[model samples]
Target: MATTPAPATKPLHLVYTVTNIQHKVRMLDGTKVSYSSWVKLFQLHAKGYKVMSHTDGTQSPAKTDTEYEAWAEIDAIVLQWIYGTLSDDLLVRVLVTESTAYEAWSRIKAIFLNNKGSRVAALEHEFNNLTLKSMSSLEAYCQKLKELGSQLNDVDCPVNDQQLVLQLVRGLPAEYDIITSYINQILPTWETACSMLELEHHR
Candidate 1:
């Protein structure tokens, strides 16, 4: 009986085209903008291979022929995707060179993730200094405050509801004395405080 040979597997590069990536994950630029989204996209694309640990060449046992081959293919694909997304300057600066995908991933994460503390501190400083000018629209001011608060929360330094409300009330100009007094008395949530301020602004 003649048995049919198994079909050859397609090359990983052809299987996953760079163009097919709806949102390409770029190298980490200084700005953290779109970083979370990029990380999510890369994780989704590199599922099953993204978190694999890199061998140290001494501590780890030698990989079997099949295992080595599989790792090589996946490593090439992952590196290609990562390199493709990087800016030319960044690619030149942080070139992964002979490092495995895991090493590259770790290095990139360390570069960006290490500055989280400074980021949180900067956001807190911004929140402290933010003020609602007399001429500023109440709605716009509130939106800016909320946006800053959201950014703080993203970095795991979220301002509590009570503190946020207090901050908002305190940041108001002297012209909003009556509304501020009313809000402070009740110690309302930030949303309620914003609403009250909005009403006062409209009046």
Candidate 2:
């Protein structure tokens, strides 16, 4: 039979696109107000907090309404650009906390550049950053498990001694125990992220 050449495979791709949708609120008012006035209005509408500007309107005075609007527009543009690329839950969660959101944004940029664009890069970045110390401990234990397994494999033992290998594996519960512990550790962080995102439970 004649053989046909197969087409080349492409790397998995995921693209996030920002949509021009309704409900896009302007972060600032169109009125040309002083910095203090602008900030006061913004807080009143968005956060229900009353804010007062203490600056003397010099040396980096509060943002002008236009300047403030421009920055807000930039934020919307950036966020819109990244919107659909993230799971809705993740988006919502990060939006809840400025710290978490900024951390996520920084990590996302680093990961996209570092990995040449992969959603896995984003996930790995979040995972590694969020679970550093625990992950280090888990990795060390996993390495030990692999070393012990290798030692057992290299020994000159009869096939019947497979039971001995099983015994050795069974006796060392550290690896399995650690895996469960790691999972437990991850669950809470994930839950926190999800909660911040405002995703409701299925149950």
Candidate 3:
């Protein structure tokens, strides 16, 4: 008869301050580190952060202040609170209104990459001028998108813009449900229009 397996050892509970935890996670064998090392990860986890471990962490992506993911992470954290998993603390405050602002800005970024030339620049301008006071409802976002679409009609498409847009939208954050909702509603229209335009221009 096989002997009973030895009692399993309890997993370690390591205490960590909110600060410096990110550094610890970046160290050796750190992926296996406990939750508290970066409690923020757990908080994000609850809110559905899909891009935790980048593909081959060895190849560092540019960590620029202007990088969309940096701002996206903030939106994700705020979304957690909006969804009620995270509590707003003095140190980790997240305002829903601010998160909504970024949501619109990210959508503008999406439109910019999908189109080309002066249209992208025009979208960048419009997004820069988007005021919190002006866009009080989701309808405002839809109107903004329509306004951008008309502007795109005036610009020439880049050679690879279609492929680039497909890849970028495909890779966008899944937790931004509202964005995804609008995407689902609009992507079919985008594909049909772009495909027809490409065929006309090439043929």
- Clashes per candidate (backbone, < 3 Å): 0, 3, 0
Per-model lDDT: 0.66, 0.33, 0.38
Candidate No. with top lDDT: 1
lDDT of 2 by residue, 81-117 (tens): 3332344444554453333223444543342234434
Off by over 4 Å in 2: 1-62, 97-104, 107-203
Model 3 misplacement above 4 A = 1-120, 124-134, 157-187, 190-203
Give the CA lDDT, 0 to 100, for residue 52 in model 3.
Answer: 31
Q: Write the per-residue lDDT of candidate 1 for residues 1-203, one digit (tens) a residue.
A: 99999999865543245454436554544343334545666776565343233322222224765567666765666666666666665567557559765666566666545688998888899888888883267777777777677666656676688888888988888899998898889998887888888888889
Candidate ordering by lDDT (highest first): 1, 3, 2
Q: Where in model 1 is the C-alpha error above 4 Å? A: 1-64, 80-93, 115-120, 132-156, 160-169, 174-203
As for TM-score, the candidate ahead, 1 or 2, is 1
By summed lDDT, the worst window of 10 consecutive residues in model 2 runs over 49-58
Model 3, clash count? 0
**CA shift of 44, model 2, Å:** 36
Candidate 2, residue 58: lDDT:
20
Please, what are the lDDT tens digits per residue for candidate 3 over residues 83-120?
A: 23222231133233454433432332343344466655
